[model samples]
Target: MTAKPTANTRTIGSHFTRAGKYAVLSFQAALTIFPIIWVLSNSFRTTDQILTSIRLVPEQFALDNYLNVWRMTSIPRALVNSLTIDIVSILLLLAVVLPLSFVIARFRFRAATVIYLFFSLAVLVPMVTVLPMTFKLFSELGLLGHKYAIAFIYVAEQLPLSVFLMVMFMRTIPSELDEAAIMDGCSILDLFRHVIIPLSRNGIVTIVILSFVAIWNDYLTALVVLSRQADKTLSVVLGYARNEYAVDYGMMSAAIIFAIAPMILIYILVKNRLIKGMAMGAVKG
Candidate 1:
């Protein structure tokens, strides 16, 4: 027979459990944020100081690193290019993936499973595996070094996972909703636009944020396809900085900070929606 704890003992146990969880959570958070803090701190340090110092905090603060990175590097232009690519790719993803997912989820077809399997397989194929062939294709099409080229590739790469996620979430939405819309004299397009899209907003947001993050951070595809400095995105531009400003630790740090800033801002703004969307999609799937 086991003895029951008194109220005081139970309260103490509960407090201990909560404290342990908080401690674990805080540790994890620190692990995640530490590098970012270090990078930011080092960005303000002189090159010699950064090279010499073990601690992240600089003895003397300097803003010239940021100024040098901004003025000398193609960071500003690269940022614009990244933004364009991300926005265009996201829009195209919405156009193509959402409808495709709806069809796969709502309708039963003979080739549905096979098609989905093929797409799932495509997702497993790394961009590196196809980069050479993709480069040849882009060259032949005269799309190499073009912003839209990157946008197109990003959309293609993102479609499989986006569709997969959307399909799972779409399944959670009752077929009754589609039937109701149809009974109200809604066409297929209308059903998708007014009913399905509205209902799947959370899932869409999740896809958008995920895709943006991926495309924004991508360097491999940009390196392979974009030949000109002017055409390069932030990732590629940052790569150049690694070589060109190798001795300038402060400048390099500043560039890294700039590269990560957009992603940080986006995560902060859409964190709640992102979590909700992921949870809903996971539960439905």
Candidate 2:
């Protein structure tokens, strides 16, 4: 007969397993962070240094590349445009999805299931599939090159998934709370505002963060929609930073850092909430 493992043997096995997990995670983190460090190192070096040396560490740091990038790119305007779009779109998404999800989760209407299923399926449709039609529709509406108006597309793109996640999260709330609130003379709007919305805070934050990241990082839609130079987003301007014949590596690196700064700052601010919200919301939903 085979012998059962002793406590000492099990403890040794667990230690090895834990050490292996850490080793793998540490290696992955290095791989992910190395490219960002390499780009930053390049941003501080001169064009000559970048071409002549492949070293990840620059001999010394300088501000010339960043100063030049500021002059060459529409940093101030594009930054404002990107921030406005992301903020507006996220607000619109939350405002619409919150009430809508609450209704679908709380009520037993005839078409609730059908509406939920429709939104769930809509989440599967890729934005690329409708690009041509979307372009034509916007053109016909005379909204091309309009900065604030373009946020409508971001709202639309994220709507279905937002509804789906919200509904899932809202469903997890106890229906008993709704009934109690109604018994206490709460109206539909009041029940939603005071009861359901407060309970689904984590889920709502998750949706906002996800929507913000998705809209901010999108280059394709912005490139096609914002045709005017004045209305172009940061990603679009970054794409055009290189000259046709000659590309400046150091300046391009600085431009990239500039473009990614907002996202990095956002992550730093909300990382704890993002972790908690994603864990509590998506997992519960």
TM-scores vs. true structure, each candidate: 0.84, 0.85
Would you list the C-alpha lDDT of every candidate in the order shown? 0.84, 0.83
Q: Which parts of model 1 have CA positions greater than 4 angstroms off?
A: 1-32, 59-61, 272-285
Q: For residues 1-285, what per-residue lDDT tens digits would candidate 1 score against the true structure?
A: 244557778899999999999999999999998888888999888877787875657676778888887788889899998998789889988998988898898887999888777766766688899989989999999988576777778888877778888898789999999889899999999999989989998788788887888899899999999877788999998888878888887888899999999888987998887666557545533
Worst 10 residues of 2 by lDDT: 276-285
Q: Clash totals for all models, in order?
A: 0, 0
Residue-level lDDT tens digits of model 2 in 136-239: 99999998857777777888788776887788789999899989999999999999999999999978878898788878898888988887888888887777
Model 2 compared with the native: what TM-score? 0.85
